[model samples]
Target chain A: MSGEVIRRARGAVAALVLVGLVVAPWVVDDYTTALLARTLALALVGVSVALLTGVAGMPTLGQTAPYAAGAYACAVVGSRVSDVGVVQLVVAAGAGALLAALIVPLVVHARGVIVLMITLAIGELVVVVLGRWRSVTGGTDGLAGVPAVRPFWGLPALASDQGRYLYALVVVATLVGAVLVLLRTRAGLVLRAGRDDETRLRASGHRVAVHLSGAHIAAGAIAGAAGSVLVVAQQYISPADFGFDTSALLLLGVVIGGTASVGGALVGAALVIAVRDWLFGVLPGHAPLVLGALFVATVYLLPTGVNRARSRLSEAAAPQPDPPAAQERATVGEVGR
Target chain B: MTAVAVGTNRIDPYLIPALDGVAYGLLVFVAASGLVLCFGVANILNLAHGLLYAIGGYTAAALLDGGWASLALALAVGVLAAAAAGVLLAGLLTPVATGSHLSQALLTFGVALAGGSLLVAGFGPDDPQVQVPATLEGSVMVAGHRYAAYRLVFIVVAAVLAAALYLVVRRTRAGMLVRAAVDDPEMVACLGVSPARIRAGVLAAAGALAGAAGVLGAPIIGPGTDTADTVLLLSLVVVVLGGLGSMAGTLLAALAIGEIQTLGVALLPAAAPFLLFAAMAAVLAARARGLAVRWRTA
Candidate 1:
């Protein structure tokens, strides 16, 4: 296909997704609508993971830090000030970005396992600080009493579950669209390039660290936004909400959905949240077993994740523009980078 | 090391804690040594390593009788069981043996999560206790402070194991082959040695070591829902700081971290958790590649 055709197709798909999201809350049951909202919020974190791990070629287990940062930011602001929902969300995002900036430089300096461990350590540090700063953070009890979110200037407070879900959908969809646009930019291209060959990208005079830092901060911001949405929707924020398990689950969602693709992240997040919720409803104590089995099976069965399946389906109708060999090379290049 | 004056005014209050830190660090070494070996030989950052450690602890908790004979029996069972679990895990991962580290990590993490829950299911939510033998249950006076005798035994056992591993890796033909395989698996295979078999062997040995640590260290650390996760995190820290696949590096890093943790707690309990992470960040920032050693030669 020609570049024009490909671009048009991509735009059409994005528009369709937006339409689907807009209509989803009305179509689904109340429980599912709430679930969808939670899924989208989680997917925002998945988006961050995809950008950092999938696109920028950095593996981080420390996203929970920014996650908690955003949650607490909104919780603190919302509790103190009344009904400035939009402002709270912005502050939450900024809080995430700020937290990311504090650690990304140190993390970016290291490579491979060193990077992995340092980010993980930073994440643990965030949890410790949150737990210890009881006077400020409310310690293990968590900060509560988050007011209803007024998502926009003209909009009334999102008091109903459906209203909150739609608000979350709007925020998540906008971020998703923004990420898609960002992917087309010079910085985004450099981020992907850095993942493929950092040394070459560096030799070619692209500031790899800067690109990486930007990606990290972007991920943090998205996660922060997600956290703020979660806080507003639940009207509660707790350290347990963004623990290691959440970080792990977010990474798993990114991988299961297909990293390096916005749609994949959304699908992965939705799947994770759905499965967890469904399993809890049906099989209360056995969710971990099933979840673990799913994780192993996903890795074994869909090595490249559900994105590969999506591409395969698309190929049946459209014949993928790139040859199999080129795609294979891309896969090889992307893994373990 | 015990030469510090006993009185409160004599020396650094942290000195005793630091010595205690040494004992704690040795236990860490015992748990992490296997993980480092697995990474060094097989290039697998086994996330289920903590599960194996837990398995060992639980085995001792469930099976061990009271006396010395039972203790020896328990150690043997724990090591063998862990070794078998390692072999099984490696078998499960054989298909993705040459795959990306991400998949390997995910698979192991899956095992940790699921296997951890299974342990709770089988053993109940309560943290399992492994009783120290009567002879080893008492405390010894050290610098006018009483310290658990089991800790000293742990130090001796870990030190001996460390020394033995050094000798084997440095002097033995099998160790040479293992090191060579790590550096260049294909080259070793070209010379008619099966790197896969060697990796399996190393993984089993690592599991056994982890099991031994779990059985012996259970009295101190114990097994619980979060034990595997916590131990996995700490062990990974030790491996990263020590340099992947380097035993001596693991030992040094473990000892240093042990002291930092114990002493940090002694000084400021609230900040203790952050101290290790802070130290790790500082180390990684200063030495971007980590304190990794040359694979084949080192």
Candidate 2:
């Protein structure tokens, strides 16, 4: 449709997300909201993942390395050294970014599946080192009993899971919102263009490798920050927290929900967590079989993801293109940089 | 006295141990074979392949620990059980293999997650170990020290299996079909072979290999969540280092990596991982494009 309508629709979606963030915790149980809080904390990684994979076409398997880095940094810093939330987050991001910077350059020139293989290998390396390095990581069982991170300006406590979920909710919301805005900016637009057509962008004189490197580090930073927040909320840090399984599950969530929109990450996260717990109770030996089957079906039926599929199906049924006026109105939508 | 004697005699510590690395290498080979088959043949980088290994360990542990009627039966059932699971996963993954690697990765990752959950639920997140069969236990002298007899058997069995695979792939009709299938499925189909059947058979074979490795190595690795991720990484390292669709490369790579891991640990216990990564990084950097090459023939 017209640019004005499209802009307005975007604004509406933003409003809906904001409203949902405020009201959602009031209704859902402590476990789900906490899980959602984890998802929100975790979604920041997805944002960077969407940036790199959805836009830049890099298949990275160890997004969780950064997440684990951030988590452990936050844990060690928050619990052992200090309780300041800001310091923890900064350390998480800084540590993650530093690690990503070191490794991403090594594989920056790789694309598609190779990037994933390298990252998955890195992920294993991170876990293995952490699991073995007893002095820093506390070894295999993980560090338990991290304090509830912080309340703003020396505020009073919400110590229970519900209260912690609410606190985490605010942090996750602000970060996710900031990222969503950042993705709407010039760098994001350029990355999307690079993803869609790297050669053409390179022909137009953009340093594609440099851009990919930036996205890789940025993703790690986001993941690291999420890990930091996770440590705060869980009040526990263990090798198990940032295990490869966590990375795989998050990636699985992205796959189930499809990657085009932020909502897909959310849906994927909720579906993944809920299914695991439910299956734990019900599925017995057939758990992998069922999950694998579900994933396979999702691929065949809605490869573009649920929302994309819905949009496509609806558009197919409606048989109407956006009005010329609408298309003409939002040149800003095309404006990336 | 033994340690002093061994140190004074100065027997070639490096060489025999290097040979000793062969047994460990063979174990990794059997373990990685299933993954190579799935990754190259089915074109699915199944994230949950390690979970299958872990499950195999658990299956062996449960049967052997739970007082199953026969140790041989437990091993057989454990391997078959894993193969059956593979067949089931093959059915699930066949449709999605055509999708983006991300989707395939996610599907498999989710399965891995669910697999972990199932493992925890069933085994209560505790470590489970399969008792070494009496026949497989005890040690044989290798590098001035007695090594596990089972490991020697492992080396022999894995070597035999690898030879059989080479023979099958090189000399047999099925090998010819698989080689041709890798090049072009459409062409293979036109040549009067069912691609689906071949794919299923390869996947099942992969599962069997993974299961056997899991059960056999359970005493060494144990039944745990670590099984999936570690084995998966090793498999990736093997197939990639060796180059896809090259059994020789897979074997050689598996041995090299196995040696790297063991020797690295032997030399530097705390810093083995970095050494591991450094080796891979050097290799990958040396041949930037010699990674996974999906051969598409017109």
Candidate 3:
């Protein structure tokens, strides 16, 4: 129950999850492998959601806009320009970053629920454009027959479900690792500070909006890269794939994972999306019903998130004189009041 | 002279869409007013507001049979049903009332998702047809363009509802209490009226408004799988654009949105989808400072 022991346990659990992911494609059936690949792509998007929602003090449902931009861009470039996964990823990331940059002005000043609403609108608008822009996007039918992607030059193109799953896993791990490293930097500290108290950060002469805008672009790039992986995994892209439901589910996944933890976001999002895909496969029309129930239960039971609950347990066992994290959480809870 | 003539010709084809915008805007106003009140007074962002509206839409679809009596029955049933749903939501929200907006959103969104699926399960997955009253089902000539009579009736109904709401909020003791609660819940609580009751009452009223909009607007928006999302998004846009609490601002924002959705689409079909959000982002970004101040104070 000590903090050190809790950290070690978390490390061990992460390693076990990684090992499981690495071996999953080989053990699972092709359908499950494909599903896992899709979940990986979505989980990566969840990391970006957490980056903004947890790290930067902005809860967004519009990451899908940049995600879709990255996806369609990757799909287009994959078909016409290159099939190399790296090239597609760069294009997708650039597309996503560009879209995020454009939207920075709209969201930078907004806080709390206003950001959520604005992002929700932005996300819906992207879907609308995707559904209507048939000439390039193929309308609601989405782009199909996206060429297979090679992980690198001279590498064989992904052909089987297992191959695609491994490709997605590797990409997700690399991007997630990058995000983890990035969050340990000064930029992350500033973002967390701003989240805790923007007024104090501003008084300290920090350009809070600039840091947020940077975080927004970085998250967009990450989501966009994930979109490329999604195209690679599914080999088809459509507006329905990035609908409001996807954004909502991703947000819930972040909440479940602990909004402030990147690893938690990854796992939580994957778990949520995986469950949804599985439920749809097994239960057909009742997926939303179950997922909705899960969301409500998550809110009620895991008010702070799965990660936070564990930390709280550890803290309770080894009580601290004054926990800054707990105090920060208290401030976060006061948002929108 | 030639340019002006071309402009007139161009505008001729969009007259109906322009009128449709007015009707659409009014519906959005009705739906969003409830959201404004809930957020403004109760400070609870009810994501299930759309579900409440859908309840009304489904009720209208189920009860209306193109008869006057059916219309009256649908309105009554829809309002009552949606009001009850709102009260249920208030009960559900009781625990999370003091939680962050995220928790409240998650809870309400869950209710919306669960309630939406339940409605679908009960009503079937397909978009159900809604029959309006026989007399109002027909089209009427307006400036030489034939328009749906049902849509025209929205203008009158919405205007009356808006005026009544304005009066109630401005003149009645309950209205003063609601305003006082928004400004200072502690002060309102000190006066002996439970803030919880006010919260529940506000949600119920909001639900009734949404239900009425849903039932009346059913012929246009319809009860379907996508209805809840569409209404929720539009109402959210209206509420945000209108700056949350002010009814007049909400009405204006709704009207602008209706025009953009209808007339803007007609004028620029190629750029139709990007129009609404683009305008929203532009307006919000332009007024960011004002909005931040307003949000802080609100």
Candidate 4:
């Protein structure tokens, strides 16, 4: 297929998915609607993971730190301060950004697996804090009965499951659209350039660290906003929601989605988390086993990712002097060493 | 006289935890050594290193029965079992030998998740009991404080193991080859030694070390659903803080971590949870800054 044709097809599919999501609550039961809302929140996190792992060349398992920060912040704000959705979201994003800013020094200079380990440590520490800080976070049990959120100041609070699901869907869509727009800007170009060749970008006087810090903070903000959506969707939040497993699964989902594609990340994360939730309901003890096996299979079957493999097939027809993908793989291999 | 006694009493409360820290630190060192070797020599992250440790832990839990013969048998079985698993991981990693760390991590993490659940299924979901030899199961007096004999045994065992590892790495021809490979794999390959075999050998040796640690440290850390994650996190912390490859650095980092977890927690209970990662982030950022400075000057 030609590039134009593939792009058109993808647009059509995305449109179909949007329409389907809009009507999903009506088609499915309340339980399924609630689950989809939760999935949407997680899928947004997946987008942030892609922003760091793919675009910024910093594969992180620590986005959850900001995510948890946003969540707990939203929960606290929603209960004591304001029950307004927009207010909670802004606070959550600020909270997430603040946490990301705090850890920027720890992660900004690291690359490859080193970034991963540091982020993993940060995420674990956040979870530990959440588990221990009983007065604020309600400890391991999490904050339950978070007040219902009004989408706007004058609007009625979301009461029904479908209402909450629709609210989450709108929030996710708006944020995802914002991210897509952000990526089209010069800032995104610099991030991609830095990811491909940091030394060259630095030599060009791009101020690579500043751009990376911006991207990191932005991703954190997006993840934090997702945390507010999560608070609205479930009306409960806990450290369990932001465990290492969630981060791992989100990273895997982003990979499956084609690491650099925001849309792919959303779909990929939703599918993975949905599968996990479904497996828990159906197989009980066998969720990790099946999901793990799927992860291993995905690595072998779609090494580049679902989106990249499809594009690579089309790009194969016109042979170039050098493929950037191959170069990327080589550089990644070197970085690992 | 009163002031002197008061000071002694204040210091006396922390004596056992300080001793416990040494034992815990040594166990972490033993477990983390395998990770250091895998990443340093083989260039494989081996995220499943914790699962390998858990294999030995489960073996110890199943086999040890509070007898000397049981202890010997458990060590043998644990070492063999974990080494076999390591060899299996080597086989699995062979295909991804030249892949990115992300791919390697995905594969190994998959194996860890699947393998961890399988172990849980086989061993049952609850934490399993581990039996130490009858003589070592009792407490030993140390600095006027009674400490668990099993934990005390770790100090001696770990010292002997560390010495053996040091000698092997510094003295043996195989160690020379391994170090040579790390410095320049292409040159080592040019010399006609099979790098693949060396990779396999390193993984097997790493597994044996982790297995032995698991079996011996089982009485302290125990076998449970969370054992793999806990051990993996600590080992990664040690590896990162130790500057990735140096054994002496790894040992010191592990000891620091051990004290922080035990003694630091005791000293500042409110800040206990933040101590380890705070220290790690601080050390890593400082090193990165130092490297940036060096790079600029050079």
Query: Model 4, B137-238: lDDT tens per residue?
Result: 788888888888888878899889988988898899988888787666667878998878988898998899999999999987898998988898899889
- What are the per-model DockQ values? 0.38, 0.21, 0.50, 0.42
Local distance difference test scores for all models: 0.76, 0.69, 0.85, 0.83
Q: What's the DockQ of model 2?
A: 0.21
Extract clashing residue pairs from model 4: none
True contacts kept of 4: 0.38
Proportion of native contacts kept per candidate? 0.31, 0.25, 0.58, 0.38
Interface CA root-mean-square deviation for model 3: 6.9
> Candidate 3 lDDT, tens digit per residue, B1-298?
9999899888788999998998899888899899898888887778898999999999999999989998889999999999999999888878763635677778888899999999999999899999888898789998778889988997788888888988998999999998887776767888999977998999999999999999999987899988888898898889778886576888899999999999999989888877987788777878877876676456
Chain A TM-score values for every predicted structure, listed in order: 0.85, 0.82, 0.91, 0.91
DockQ of 3: 0.50
TM-score of each: 0.88, 0.81, 0.93, 0.93
Residue range B1-298, candidate 2, lDDT tens digits: 8998787566455554555578768877888888877766666677778877887888878877433355566679878977887887777667753535666676677566666767777886678766766766688887566777877876787788778878988999887877776665657778888767876787788888888888877776688756777788887777656666478777888888878877657767767657767777676667654442221110
Q: What digit string (tens of lDDT, one per residue) describes model 3 on residues A1-337? A: 6999999999999999999999988888999898889999999999999999888878888999999999999999999999999999999999999999999988887676667878987898789889988899999999999988998999998889999999999999999998888889898899888776565677789998899999999999999999999999999999999998899899889988888899889888988898888888888889889988988888888765633322222222111224464345443443223
lDDT of 4 by residue, A230-300 (tens): 99999999899998789888988988888888998998899889888988899889878887787787777
- List the lowest-lDDT window of 10 residues for candidate 3 chain B: B95-104
- Summarize candidate 1's per-residue lDDT along B15-118 as a digit string, tens digits: 67887788778888988888887776676768789999999989889877668888888899999999999998888788873535566777877787788878
